[model samples]
Target: MIKIGTIELDGRAVLAPMAGVTDRAYREICAGFGASYVVSEMVSSKALQFNDKKTGFLMDLGEAERPAGIQLFGDDPAVMAQAAKKAMAYRPDAIDINMGCPVPKVAGNGSGSALMKTPSLCGEIVAAVKEAVPVPVTVKIRKGWDKTSVNAVEIAKICEAAGADAIAVHGRTRDQMYEPPADWEIIRQVKEAVTIPVMGNGDVYTVQDAVRLLNETGCDLVMIGRGALGNPWIFQQINAYLTDSCRILPSPGLYERMSVMVKHIQRLCAYKDERHGMREARKHVGWYLKGMRGAAEFRRRAGTLETMDDLALLVRDIVAANSVAEEAGR
Candidate 1:
């Protein structure tokens, strides 16, 4: 177990907050599969301050999922503090400041990773949020604004000094975006430099990668982002691999996969209207079929689906066809 302030997480594997992903349905799924913690998608402090309906909807954590963190992004200290306070109403286990998003619109406004360039301002934001909330306050950061400024260690120290309970370091410079390799060495350095629990993220695609990150970086936790796109089983795989060095089990057969996908769609429908749910399910369906045989055709069908019934029928067909093909191969 790893302790972040007074809260104890069951394991070291966490789900990284992704903008349109990591909603309540996904968080509950990951928690069921053994993820230690899950962070909500980044919400704008400005939007929260304005009482945006969409932003308020994003903060909603269904009764099934608890102990999740709500992450906020903004450049203004007062606004950030107020946002953190507002997020507290949702009863998140913690509040996280997003200092690592490399998106142009976000960083261009001096929020997200732009905070890395102003260490003192970042420190002030952390202090303000920490003072405003009763729960643990954490900060997520990148290596630096770019390769030339690589100052995560320095910024991490400032956050710790400002009373952050923990720090999560994504080991890629803002310029790298989601590129080649994530510099685990820099993650290692940050872990070594900080007193609070450090969670290492980037390029962790498999259970072996998770093990390697822990062994190499000595970080208290590993946060999985792109790797968990269609693979919620990753949490179970990592957990099993850590406890027992067996080659982790493969994904379930086509029928089982379809069952999970169907459940995801139903959950989405329950959370939003049928039209919005079907629309959102398109991206998830694409991710679910990724790399599988006939996935291109399946993706095309899934994208054009107009109703829940259409989606369910399409998934059933995909499963049956795939199972028949597998039998023929055998």
Candidate 2:
């Protein structure tokens, strides 16, 4: 068991926080699928300092999603420290600092991956948050600001020295956002450099990928991002493979897939209310329909979803079409 301070992470696979995607509802859904740990969507330090009410929802961790972390992004040490203190009110098991996000809104503001450029400030922010919060402090950092820099080890060591409990290394530099072939070697380097636990992240899309990453880098955990987007079952598959003699679980059946998708969207609606949740469900529904027979057309209808009834209708249509496709194949 890996302990982020006092919190014991029971599994090696974790859900990486996505800005607009990893909400409270989604975190609970992923946790139900055996993700050892999950993180909140990125919260702004400045927003916390100014007492933004909307952020309250972002930091909400349900009992089902135990041992979750609330991720905060900002470069200012003092502000981040205050944000950590505030996030503690939501009772996160740990406070994770977001130093890995490559989005321009964050990086352009001298936050997120931009913090990787200033190793000293990164250290200061970790030390400050560690001081302000009662829980453990962790950082997520990229390989570097650009291809020319490549300084993850330097920053990892600094954060460790400054009281960071753990570090997650995304293999690409900020310059290569979401590019193929994430440099897992950098993750290996940071794991070797730091005594604290290192999580290897980037390009892990399947059970084999997760196992290979763990076997290859020897990191403490595998943090999965986009790969887990519409595929929470990846966690279950990874768990089975790791614990069950490398068994590969087949993908969910069509009925089970539709059932889970509807349940996920229903929870999203329950959490965010029907109007906002339905809008958010568009992309998620699209993701769920991936690889289905006649999926392109279904996804087009998913985009136009306006209410629970609309979603129910779309799901019924998907199930009917796929059922016939399966029957014919047999």
Candidate 3:
């Protein structure tokens, strides 16, 4: 059990806050699968300050998923503080500042990873948000703007001094943009430099990788990002690997996997409306079918689906066709 401030989480596996993903339904699913903590997708402080209806929708959380952190991105100190206050109404377990997003639109505005270039401003932002919210505040950051300016250790010190409860370090530079390998040494350096708990992110694709990261970096937790896509079962896999050296179980068979996909679609459809839910489920459907037999043909057919009923039919048909082909090959 790890403690971030006064709150004690059940374990050290956390879900990274991806912008389009990590919504309420996704968070609950990850929690059910044994993730210790889940962060909300990055919400714009400007949008929250303006009371944007869409941003408010993003903050909705069911009662069961407690100890969830709400992440906010913005360059302005006052606006960020105000946004934290507004977000507190939703009863997030903590508030996280996004100093790590490398996207041009977000960084171009001096928010996200752009803050890495200004340590003083980043400290001020952290201080303001920490003062404004009664809950614990944390910051997520990349290694630095690039190789020459690799300053996560310095920035992490500033954040810690400014009263952040913990820090999450993604080892890639801003220019890397989720490419190649993550520098575990950098995460180790940050963990060594900080007094608070440090969470490591990037390239943790399998249970072995997660265990290796925790052992190598000596970080308090491992945050899984792209690794969790269409594979929420990873939490259980990692936990198993951590406890024993034995090989973990493989993912479910094709029919069972399709059942999970269908359930994900149905939950999204219920949480959001059918039209929006079906639209959003398309990318997930594609992810679920990736590398499967005849996935290209299945995806082409699935893409044409416009309603939940159509989606269910396409999935059932694909599962049935695959099962028959496997039996014939035997």
By TM-score, the best candidate is: 2
Q: Which ten residues in a row have the lowest lDDT in candidate 3?
A: 238-247
lDDT of each: 0.90, 0.92, 0.89
Question: What is the RMSD, in Å, between candidate 2 and the native fold over all Cα?
Answer: 0.8
Off by over 4 Å in 3: 244-247
Clashes of each: 0, 0, 0
RMSD of each: 1.2, 0.8, 1.4
205-270 per-residue lDDT for model 3 (tens digits): 888899899999999999999988888888877876665565696876887778777877888888
Model 1 C-alpha lDDT per residue in residues 1-330, reported as the tens digit of each score: 898887898878999999998888888877878888889999999999889999998999865665689999999999999999999889889999999999999999999999999999999999999999999999999999998999999999999999999999999999999996999999999999988999999999898899999999999999999898878888888888776666687876666677787888788878987898888889988988887778999999988977888997897788777888899999
Candidate 2, residue 242: CA error in Å?
0.8
The candidate maximizing lDDT is 2
- TM-score winner between candidates 1 and 2: 2
